[model samples]
Target: MKVIHIAGWSGSGKTTFILKLCSHLVHRGRTATIKHIGSHYCALPLGKDTTLHFEAGADPAVGIDDEKTSAVFHGICLDDALNLLSDSGVRYAVLEGFKGMPFQKVHIGILDGPYLLKNPEVSEVLSVLDQFDDWYTPSGLMKELTDEYPGCHIFSWAGYVTDYQKTKDLCSRIEDEYGDDPLIAGIRARVHRWSDDGRYPVYLLMAMNNPFADAAIFFRAIQKIEVCTLS
Candidate 1:
């Protein structure tokens, strides 16, 4: 997931630009989510059931209907929201305001600041999409941990398997080989999307011992997985 912040003075066409960019992304078969930060306080209707539920101590109040579902969560910071979007497989995350936050920016109007684009069209932004910062995800977090701990031996795999039965057999084989091994500290396998054909974006992370522990004690945990065939 990538993050882009659209910032400018009030009434500077930020909203219009976002709509156009999102439409283009949809046409290209990519997913995008937006977060709008406003300066004023926006309140819900006084007698609405959702508002009542919030007033009755529900931290997050949700209302469901046929067309859409509305949810309001209190006390969540900006980074937390972006992480949620990344975990849900959003390809792009756009921010209407929040110029102060440190991320790539697309300035508008006569704003005096650093930006990747200034009042440019959607295609221009798409051409330079790689300039934006990547949002947080479990895989990214594990990579960061590996960088921090040089002694850690990490084996990670992500792929699209078109055979459902073969995927199951592979997972069972891994667990049977490593489930009782004391040296292995963590094993994570998740299917991000599944269909009749099989699963796409399956992620597996297996680490030997706790990388955060003393390096000397975990030195023996780096032994090779002799029975491992997922390489």
Candidate 2:
């Protein structure tokens, strides 16, 4: 998944820009968004069902309507939320107000001054939504990852499959190659079967830290297998 952050001072149009960007992405692909309500308390209605459920110790109170669905998760960390989005098969994730995160950012309005420009991670600065361009199409973003991270391998599958055995086979191959390395082995332990609707796609991304690991081998192994690519 491609993750990016949008940040700016209060009333600097962060929310508006995010809404527009999300609308654009939704028309062309799948997208997820996270808004950080930092340091402020979000109060629920005193007698609402969702609030009552939370008060009764329902950790994440979820409410679904015919038209929409919302979840209230108290005290959840950013990484955990990100993992949830990834597991749900989001292609793009745009975060609002996670400024210091290592993910690339788009600054919505002016920074304080030149001192703020010292940070090297800012990818774009926009004063208004009209300046937005399609520079980061899905294929373009995937290409950027491959260019920036040399050893990264991306495997994707779609369409009807008999079962989860195919994914397991690919994971087994990866484990066979790197299971001896303690760090890689630890990461391998976390790999498990992914089962979601075939209508929605799935992606597996492996970034090898071992300098000797050949990403080409992974490509070659799966070359004959039917797979999806960022288009």
Candidate 3:
């Protein structure tokens, strides 16, 4: 799914802009989900079963009714949430206030910074939707990998990255460090240069004989790569 991030200071009409954007998308028969990232704490329903379950150490406490479902999660990061939304098959994932996120941004006010658009109308955003970045889950990455490098057994992978150069350098390091090992086989990387804005999203995958133990090492190696992202 394409990712759109709306960023601005308080009172910049961000919520109104997002509302208009989502409404327009809905009218056009598009599916979208919005995530609001706020600094202040939002209180849950007092004495509710879900809240009680959450307080009692459930990472994500879910409640279901005839009309809808509610979930309260603890310590869930933005990427995790986005992954969840992407898995739900939304066409557009709009981020309300994550200014620091790496994706292309639509700023609501004129400010001293770089953004895709300055106080753009919903139509303007739609005109340049192809310039936005894409998000990927592990399954998505594996699908891409399988399509590109058939016959290579990629048991595990890490992805949804934006920095191609850094990831390439890290992959080279991983090759030098572990390529000769018999356990880790067919280490592969894909740098997707499809974004109209010149950003490269990358994916790295490998087949491991011992998935549980080797995946830990693979992720630790991935963490050493310093990432620089586009706004």
RMSD of each: 14.6, 14.6, 9.6
The TM-scores, one per candidate, come to 0.60, 0.51, 0.61
What C-alpha lDDT, on a 0 to 100 scale, does residue 162 get in candidate 1?
Answer: 56
Best by lDDT: 3
Give the per-residue Cα lDDT of candidate 2 at 186.
24
Model 3, runs deviating above 4 Å: 27-39, 140-231
User: With candidate 1 superimposed using the best TM-score fit, by how many Å does residue 35's alpha carbon deviate from the native?
Assistant: 3.9
Clashing pairs in model 3, backbone N/Cα/C closer than 3 A: none
Q: Each prediction's Cα lDDT score?
A: 0.65, 0.53, 0.70
RMSD (CA, angstroms), candidate 1: 14.6
lDDT of 1 by residue, 38-123 (tens): 67676888999999998887878989999997877785587667756666656678888887876779998878778888999889
- CA displacement after TM-score superposition, residue 196 of candidate 2 (Å): 28
Per-residue lDDT of candidate 3, residues 138-179 (tens digit): 555565445555655566544445666666566677667766
Q: Arrange candidates, best TM-score first.
A: 3, 1, 2
Tell how far residue 210 is off in model 2, in angstroms.
30
